[model samples]
Target: MKINGEVTTGLGKAAYFLSQEFYSLEFERNLGFVPFPGTLNVVVSDDYLDEINEIKNNCQNLIKPDEGFGAVKYIPAKLCDEINGAIVFPAKTTHEENYLEFIAENKLRDQMNLKDGDIVSLEF
Candidate 1:
């Protein structure tokens, strides 16, 4: 079975972890990363990253427009007893605003009908 951990802070976006069974290839892959147990990491496919990055970049408070999409910094791996595991984080992450102001000066929001309280949801 896969082991998913609690969300860690400062990793940008939601960063759940794989613990105990983390770095176990089979476990991490459940979260969309290609398990590379040898390196205690997973390979995030380009398609996957792009889709995820887009949403993160748009989420006003999650990632600021200035900071752009938060980059993947490092996958933290820890050794327990004799096992090694890692954690992943965004290379750059900044909070833009508490609220997502979709209505830009160019009527972008109006064109898309994305006004306040309008939820632009996504699916993985």
Candidate 2:
């Protein structure tokens, strides 16, 4: 999915230079039916990396591997991270079956216009 987030850098070769390189990261697991990046989606702009980190934290806390079936599970996190975080857009709809289907078809992640450390609530 296209993450409308940041490219963390200052006006210099360090920032742009870094962008041209590759890196590896750890995935905590699925927070829900939504898929995490199999590979990095192009870093859009640090314009919103803060938001990405926020959602990542929230989603990581909420997700657990299902005991028998291995589906995603829900566990909530305390939301007082000090950094201002934005909730994902169409929050309520993410839980709806129809919306889930849409998410599956489109392949999605938190669409919240957030900063690094935001929360995206998925109602069960």
lDDT of 2 by residue, 76-121 (tens): 2212222121222122222212111111111123333334333333
RMSD to true structure for each model, in Å: 18.8, 15.8
Judging by TM-score against the true structure, name the best candidate.
Answer: 2
lDDT (CA) per prediction: 0.29, 0.25
Looking at candidate 1, what is the lDDT of residue 50?
A: 52
Model 2 stretches with alpha carbons more than 4 Å out: 1-40, 66-103, 106-124
Over 12-40, each residue of candidate 1 has an lDDT whose tens digit, in order, gives 22322212233224333433343331212
Off by over 4 Å in 1: 1-12, 15-68, 94-124
